[model samples]
Target chain A: MPLDPSFVGRTYPPTAPYQVGREKIREFASAIGATDPAHHDPAAAQALGHPDVVAPPTFPVIVTMAASSQIIEDPALGVDYSRLVHGDQRFSYTRPVVAGDELVCTNTIEDVSTRGGHGFLTTRTDVSTVGGEPVVAVWARYVIRGEA
Target chain B: MELPAKTFQVTRADLIRYAGASGDFNPIHWSDRVATKVGLPGVIAHGMFTMALVGRAVTEWAGSPDAVVEYGVRFTRPVVVPDDDQGTEIEVTARVREVTEDGLTRLEVTATCLGDKVLSQARATIRSAR
Candidate 1:
């Protein structure tokens, strides 16, 4: 079954605000091997001139997944969760995420396509501060294996 | 603070252990048959695993888990791990890019596996713990 074209331009409600905590950022950094003192030490970060330890650039994926759930779980989209695989991911940031900033994510189904009997779903999620200040845009591609 | 570099060898067991921990069971990571059937030359490593390793490097560098604030990366190439003595490894390099007045600093990063960039154009912002 093909994806409904009407869903292509559909947008989901912005996710609830996520408070950027210093600990969470540190944990994520450690998990990925980001050791810059600025990521862990306030004095180090301050010496370098940041408000607080900044987050790694890719941290936005944490919220984009929440925002994208709206489109992925929509039955009309005809996606099979079991068959889905992460195809690609990319992020463009206007600025790095910082502690003390409340962030929100909004997801849009950018495109739907099929190839080799498989379904491809592309999503564009924008992360912004509660005041709507743009922080980053994450583009993700998911591939659903053929249902044959 | 001065940035440091680290490297790690990713083995089949490591990938399997990560699979159990991360919940990403993509067969291309652990099954040779499935990987080759899917058009890959051989079994490959998960991009997120590579990303996670980069984070490990950061954490180890910080000397504590609470120092990092943010991290991000783009998967540029696939890392294929084979079953042999010629094991595979990834080298992660980082540099302090800039610091904001609010006390956050941005670090530029890169991860290379098997002489090719598996993660590229990576960056992270971290706050000082004081």
Candidate 2:
């Protein structure tokens, strides 16, 4: 079954605010072996003009990935989780994500298409503060592989 | 213009830590049992992990921790990570494709594993640090 093209341009509601934690940023930075002092040292981050440890550029995936389930798990959308593979990912940030920021995401389905028996779904998540300050806009394209 | 290349280690431990940190508990990244069951060669590193490595290189080249304004990539191949201390190594290299007068530097990036390209069309635009 192909993805519902009508779902394109459909926007989901804002997710609950996710409070960015300093330790989480440190852990993610450590996982990627990012030895930048600003990622682990609050004092160093302060020197850089952030309130606390600033997360690495790709850190927002921690928030967008979870919030994306709102669409992938929607029964009407019929996204087969087993066949899902990340086709592409893009992030445009207004500013770096720092610790102590409460973030919210509003997901929108931008495009849906099927080619060569593979289903492609592109979704954009507008990540912003609970107060609606734009932070980063994340775009993800997922490919649903066809049966061999 | 050419930028410096960087190599990153991708061990199973790194995959596990990335899974926990990124909340992508996909068995293909951690469980060899499930990974092979699904026809993968073995447990593999997450695509996002590779992207993160590229981000690290971008920031290093830009001379700022938060210099990236736009980043994107396509996962073309998987980085197979073994269950060992020295699991695998990904070599990331990039060239300055353009430097707009507005102070944004666009980079064309390539990430390879065992000499095979793992990411395609990987690119980043950073606010160049003067």
Candidate 3:
């Protein structure tokens, strides 16, 4: 079944604030082999004018992906999780994420379409500090394969 | 100008670690059976993982972890990872597309595994370190 184009422009509520942990940033940086001191050492991050250890560029996916579950699991939308594949990703940052920050994500379904028997869903997530300062805007496009 | 290429190795162990840290427990990234069942080649690395590697290259080139202002990529191909001690390798290279007077640098990035381009329209805009 093709995605409901009517679902486009639907916006979900903001998720609960997620406390960005120092060790989580370190672990993510380590997993990607990003040895930059700013990603690991608070002192190094402070030298760079950051309040705490900084997160790697793609680290916000950890938050946004979870936040997007609201849209993916919407029974009315009827998305097939097993057939989904990542199609595209983009991030625009107002500032880098730092450990000790409490972040919240507001998810919006930007577009939904069907082409060549496949369903495409594009979502935009606005990540912000608990105080509502925008941190980054994340966009992801997921492709749902058709049963051929 | 062309930037030096950076190569990163991806082993199955690394994938497992990433899955834990990123909280994406998708079995297709670990279970070859699930990957094949989904019509994938077999146990593909998470697309976000590959993007993170490329982000590393961008930040390294910019000389700061917070240098990037915008980054985007289209996932054109899957980086299939075989279960082994030596999984696979991704090579990332970038070219300076533009340098603004205010010191923003735009880069066109390329990432490949087994000489096949895995990402297309990959680009990053960062604060110029120079």
CA-only RMSD, every prediction? 6.7, 0.9, 1.0
Which candidate, 1 or 2, has the higher TM-score? 2
Best by lDDT: 3
How would the docking of model 3 be graded?
high
What TM-score, over all chains together, does every model reach?
Answer: 0.66, 0.98, 0.98
lDDT of 2 by residue, B1-130 (tens): 9888999988888888899999999999999999999899999999999999999999989988988999999999999998878999999999999999999999999999999999999999999774
Candidate 3: interface RMSD in Å? 0.4
Tens-digit lDDT track for model 2 on A1-148? 9998999999999999999999999999998989999999999989888889999999999999999999999999999999999989999999999999999999999999999999999999999998889999999999999887
What lDDT score belongs to each candidate, Candidate 1 first? 0.75, 0.94, 0.96
Model 3 lDDT tens row, A1-148: 7789999999988999999999999999999999999999999999999999999999999999999999999999999998888999999999999999899999999999999999999999999999999999999999999999
Error of 2 at B63 (Å): 1.0
The weakest ten consecutive residues by lDDT in model 1 chain A span A27-36
Please give the lDDT score at residue B114 for candidate 2: 99
Per-residue CA lDDT of candidate 1, range A33-144, in tens? 4677877888876675678987765566666766677888888786888777776676666766778889998889898888888888889888999999998888888878
Q: Fraction of the real A/B interface contacts present in each candidate?
A: 0.13, 0.86, 0.96
lDDT for position B53 in model 2: 92
- The C-alpha interface RMSD of every prediction is 5.8, 0.6, 0.4
Model 2: how far residue A83 lies from native, Å:
0.7
